[model samples]
Structures are given as C-alpha cells and as structure tokens.
Target: MSDTLIEAGKRTIELEAQAVKALGERIDGEFAKACEMILNCQHRVIVTGMGKSGHIGGKIAATLASTGTPAFFVHPGEASHGDLGMITQDDVVIAISNSGSSAEVITLLPLLKRMGNPLISMTGQNQSPLAKAAHAHLDISIEQEACPLNLAPTCSTTATLAMGDALAVALLEARGFTAKDFAFSHPGGALGRKLLLKVEDIMHSGNELPRVEKTALISEALMEMTAKGFGMTTVMDGQELLGVFTDGDLRRSLDQGIDFNTATMIDVMTAKPLTISQNRLAAEALGLMDAKKITALVVEDDQQQPVGLLHMHDLLKAGLV
Candidate 1:
C-alpha cells in the first residue's frame, strides 16, 4: 500500500512538472499582448474566477500587487450580486476558468464588456466562449491531469499558476521594479526590515554608547565595557575616533602580564577598528560583523568620529538577521 502511494505521488509530480514546462513553449504573441494590456491599464487589474481558478487568481493578483502592479481579486459569483461595482472603466479584468466556460465567470462578461473594461482570459480550451471573447487569451491547457482518473484540476491549475508567475515577473522587469520598491509594500516582513532598517536606527548612540578616553587606564576601559555590557569600548581623542579596546584585547593584555590599573587604553587598544557608516542598512552591518567574526562595530560619521555603536544583538532584536 505504501509503495502504491509513493509511486502515485511521484507520477503526479512528474505530470505537473511537464504541464508547467509546456507553458514555456506556449508563450507567444498572445502572452505578449496580455502583458502589454495589463501594463497599459490606467488603473487596477481586477482578477476574477470560480472554484480552484478563483484561488489561483487571488494569488496571482497578490503577486501582481506586491510587484509594482496594483491589483485585487474579486469572486466571480459575487459580481452579479453588486460586487461588479468594484470594477471600473479604467481597470483591466483577468478571468480564469479551466474550461473557459465557468458559468459564474462567463455571466459577468457582458457587463464587463459594457463597462468598456479590457478582458484577459486564461482557459484550458482555446475554442471556449470565454477565450473567444477575450482581448487576449492565455492558453493554460494541459495534455492530462495529474490525477490517476484524469478528471481532477491538478496539472491545469499548476500550468495556470506558472503562467501567472511568468506574467508577474516579466512585468516586474519591464517596470524596473526594485527591491527597495518591494520593501515599501511589505514593510512588516523580514525583507522590509533588511532593506529599510539602517545602522543609525538600531545603533546605540549618545549616552548609551560605550566609550573611553585614550589616556584612560585599561581598568577604566573595562569599567566602561562592564557598564555598557558590550564586551567592548571605543577609545576616543576629543571628537575623533582613535581605536577600540575589546574583551579580546583585555585577554591579550592579561596574557602579556600587563596591569589593567596602570596600562592606558591606547597601550591595549586595536588601532583603526572596523567602522560602519550610519546610513548603511543594519543588515549590511550584520554581514560585516559576521565576516570579520566580531560582535560589534563603531558607527562612524564622515569625519571618522564615532556616532554610534552596533551590536549583533541589535540586528537580531530588529529582525534584520
């Protein structure tokens, strides 16, 4: 019984893979025209479908909306019951139906036509009424279903989803949609944090910064490190950043029999410590720390003065990691 299930799952995956692969060869002038229509749309792209097609349409609309195009999904069944008002003359409609004849989806065609909204149809059958009526028809037809009975909507839906992704990515490139633009739409997500959270936003500044004078004893530097709990402290000369004395430097000092009470921070400090710009992304600061195997970096200004200090914990707490 287990063997049967495994073989059936493998066969299903193979069929779905073939269906998606076939979409590459099927991309032609119709696909280009569909892309052009959506691009030229003055307002939103309204996506609608029934059943499984509806579920796929929702995801497609979300992808389009998040990738520079403004789009939303509407249930085809609800269109006749006042939801049709959600669509406007300036919008373009994308209707999805495996057979291109879902009654609920097809019934809205006349009204959409009257509203002068452009129609883009995705269907498994080329000769279907929905396809015939569309300004541009996308053929999501698959040779067979992944279901053993060849009656389910498996391979066809997979093909439709791949086509939707292809459309979205092509449009993304055409519009020069950038990562920064995507981050604006998803500010609550990790990608947004990585892109928008800067070192200045998370770095410890002003009184929270751990620092000491170049003339301060190692004991004083250690006292500052303990007070701030950063396992490190910056050595400053006036407003200029001189060096850094970390726990690692302390250990080396102890190993060399140096006296913390008498030795100055300049005697034990690492000259020209790694520093990051305040305007840099916190994620980049995290990368620099990881690459250098350090726990913190001094945030520096244009004059090489220490403005702030960033710790690994800051990036983690900010969700940039």
Candidate 2:
C-alpha cells in the first residue's frame, strides 16, 4: 500500500476511536431521560433527520423496530410536506442532527410541539435550537470528523449511530425481549431459522418415519429402512421404543452370518439410541447428531413417545448444517 493511503487509514481509525470514546463521557442524565421518555411513549417512535444524520436515523429506526420497540423513520424534508400527518399526539419523535440545526429538521419543531408529540433530540451541540426545543437531548458530540477535509460527517455520524444502538439495546433489556421475539421480526434471516424452527417442523412424520416392531425379522426392519429412505428404522414394542437398527447393523449382521429371516429386530438393534424432542430446535438436533457421529435420530414427544424421525440429510436440505 502507498504511504498516503496507509496514513489516511490510520487517521480515520484514530478519529473514529476518539469519537466513540468521547461518547462515554457524554452519556448522563440526559441519556437516561431520553430512554425513559421513549419507554413511556404510548405510540410508535418517529425518527427524523437530514442528510447523513437521516441515513443513521433510518438504521436506528430499523434496530428499534426489530428489538421490540415499534419505530419508523419519516424524512424531515417530506414531513414538512404533509408527511407529518403520520405523526400523532401519542407518538414520540427522535430527531437527529449533528449540528442540532439542520434546516429540514428545525422546520418541523413548531408543528411537532403543536401536536403535543414528545421530542427527543440527538445532536452534537446541546445549546442548538433543536436541542433546546426537545423534551430530552442526547449529546452525540464528536471531537473531530474522520474525513481528511474535516467537513464530511464521519466520526460524528459514527458516534450518532452507536448512540442509537445503545438506546435500542437498553430498551430491549428493559422490555425483557428474547431471541424468540427477535426471530419474529427477522423471520427471513438465519437467526429466525435457528430459533424458530423445531424438530417437528423438519422431521419425517407418519408414513415417512422409518419404523419396525421389535418382534419383526431383521429382513423386515431392513426393508422398512430402505423403503423410508432414512437409512435407519426404530424398533418399537407397542408404544415403547425398544431399540434402533441401521444399515451398519445390517452389515455387521451379514458378516456374523446371522439369518435375516430368523433374527428379530431386538436381537440386531442397538438399544437406547439417541433421541431428540419434537419441541427442540432443529439446530439443537444437528448439534446432537454431530456430537454422537450419528446421521439420524428419533424425535419423541413430551411423553417420550416417538413422534417423528430426523436425519442429517434433512438438516442439510433445510440449510441448518
């Protein structure tokens, strides 16, 4: 790399670090008050800002919405042109502006106040007009911009984004939010697949389950495993699981010169095989199978009755592995 590029990168890291470190000293009673106001709001959070601050506000709104807080972003420029109709008296507005004087955001203050909507300002300058008009002000001041020209909003925007994350996390904890709750908001993501997908959701049920009676001949069990295409079969005595017979067992039985027609499933099966609960996460079943070096498992219900069967192939197909 060229010396100029190396120096620029170093400067950028140093400036951004300083900005984030400075935020620690800025968090105080005002930060607490901002969180309290949003937590008590009866309506959704409406985030607004201009330019780079607006971009950061959009991300903040998404984070808040995904983490148990209902929030949306309204462009300040649009809010002035009838978009403000989206705001209501029950809503809390979080306005973002590094200088605390973005013209677009400032212009909405009067109408917001008139609507009796609570205002929370995230700004670099506490004395600025936007901060002064807000019900609560969160100081997101940075020492310097990471930009070489010191004109572009760099470190200031980074600090503002981090502060938004802090607020979202605090609210998430206060609301007792869980992974399941987060999964509901992000159903299309990998986290949702891992947390929300159950063994029953992916397991082979009914006619697809490879099963054979304990009294059945080894040949009958092998036929059941082959027909079901799971490479294994559960040996059950009525409702009780007696054991499991797999392709490996068949190979061993063949080498031992065992008569398939005479050998019962109980005689060739491995007793007390690993089993999973139907309510368990598919990811959990994958872990168990990996730990045991097994390809398939019988899924049991709350009463320990085998309800379904799962295989490594199933997990692979579901993209869980």
Candidate 3:
C-alpha cells in the first residue's frame, strides 16, 4: 500500500509537470500583449475569478503587486453585488475561469466594456465567451487533470498559476524591478533585512566601539576586548584606524612568550585590517566576515576614519545571517 501511494504521488507530479510544460509552449503574442497591457496600465490591475480560479487569481494578483505591477483581487461573486464599483476605466481587468464562461464573471463584461477597461482572460477554452471578449486571451488549457478520475482542477489550476507567474515575471523584467525594489515591497520579510539593513544601522558606534590607542599595552587591548565582549579591539590613533587586535592575536602573543604587560598594540595588532563603508548592507558585511573567516570588521567613513565596529553577532541579532 505504501508503494502504491508513492507511485500515485509520482504520477500526479508527472501529470502536473506535463501540464506546465504545455503552458510554456503557449506563451506567445497573447502573453506579450497581456504583459504590455498591465505594464502600461495607468491604474491598478483588477483580477477576478470564480471558485478554484478565484483562489489562483488572488495569488496571481499578489505576485503581480509584490513584483512591481500594482494589482488587487476582486471576487466575481462580490462584483455582481456592487464590488464592480472598485474597477475604473483607467484600470485593467484580468479574469480567470477554467471554463471561461462563469456567469458571475461574464455578468461584469458589459459594464467593463462600457467603462472602456481592457480585459485579459485566462481560460482553458479558446472559443469560450470570456476568451472571445478579451483584449488578450491566455490559453491555460490542459490535456487532463492530475486526478485519477481526470475530474479535478489540479492540472488546469497549475497551468493557470504558472501562466500568471509568467505574466508577472515578464512585467517585472519590462519594469526593471530589482531586488532592492522587491525588498521595499516586503519590508517585514527576511529578504528586506538582508537587502535594506545597513552596517551603520547595526554597527557599534560611539561608546559601544571596542578600541584602544595604538600605543596601549596588550593588557589594555585585552581589557577593551573584554569590556566590549567582541573578543577583539581596534587599535586606533585618534579617529584613524591603524590595525586590529583579536583573540587570535592574544593567543599568538601567549604562544610567543611575550609579556602582556610590556607588549604594545603595535607589536600584536594585525596592521591594515580590512574595513567596510558604513553605508554597506549588513548582508554584505556578513559575506565579508564569512569570506575572511573573521568575526568583526571596522566600519569607516569617507575620510577613512573608523566610525563604527561591526561584529558577526550584530548580523545575527538583525536576522541578516
């Protein structure tokens, strides 16, 4: 029975994969026209559908909105009950229906035409009323459903969703939407922290900086490291960053039989330590730390003066790691 279930799952996946592949072949002038219509839309793209198609339409609208094309989902059932008022002549409408003849959605066609709003239809039937009426018709037809009985909307819905993604990505490319722009749309997400949070925003500054004068004894650098809890300290000359002394340097000092009391930072510090600009992204700082196998780095200003100190722990606390 377990083997039978595994086979069934694999068959379902194979069928759906084939359906998506068929949809890929259908990406042509109609798909380009749909993308262009959404791109040139002066107002929001209004998406509507019925039943399972409605659920897919909602997700497609979200994808479009998040990827730089402004869009919102409007249920066809609700539109017949006055939600149609949300759409305007300036807006473009994308209607989704497997059969392409859902009554609730078709009811809005006359009103949409009167308002001179462009309609893009995603449907399984090429000759359906909705497809015939659309300014652009995306063929999301599938040979069969992934269901054993070939009765469910499985493969058809998958094709519709993939076609929706194709439209969104095409529009995304046309608009030159970037990762930074995507981060702005998802400020509360993990990607936003990785892309938007900067070293200056999370770096230790002012009194939080772990440092010692270049002329300070190794014992003083150790004290600063302990006080700052970074296991390291910058050896500075005034505001100018001269070098860094880390726990690794301390271990080497102990190994070399150097007297901690007499040894100065100049004797123990790693000179010309790597530094990052304060304006750099925290994710980039994390990358630098990982590449160098170091835990901390100095943040410098345009004048090449140390303004802050960034540690690996800062990236962890900010959720950029």
Runs in model 1 lying further than 4 Å from the true structure: 188-191
Worst 10 residues of 3 by lDDT: 218-227
| lDDT (10s digit) by residue, model 3, range 148-263 | 89888899999999999999998999999999999999987899988899999999999888989999998788788899899989998987888999999999989999988788
Q: What RMSD value applies to candidate 1?
A: 2.1
Q: Model 2, poorest ten-residue lDDT window?
A: 141-150
Clashing pairs in 3: none
In model 3, the runs with Cα more than 4 Å from the true position are 2-7, 187-192
Best by TM-score: 2
TM-score attained by model 1: 0.91
Model 1: lDDT equals: 0.93
lDDT of 2 by residue, 1-321 (tens): 699999999999898988988888877888889899999998899999999999999999999999999999999999988999999999999999999999999999999989889899999998999999998999998767988788999999999999999999999999999999999998778888899889999999888888889899987887897898988999999999988999899899999999877889878999999999999999999999999999999999999999999999989888787
* Better by TM-score, candidate 2 or 1: 2
For model 1, residues 238-301, the per-residue Cα lDDT tens digits are: 8888899998998999899997668898899999999999999998999999999999999987
- Score each candidate by Cα lDDT: 0.93, 0.92, 0.93
lDDT of model number 3: 0.93
Candidate structures ordered by TM-score, highest first: 2, 1, 3
- Listed in order, each prediction's TM-score against the native is 0.91, 0.93, 0.89
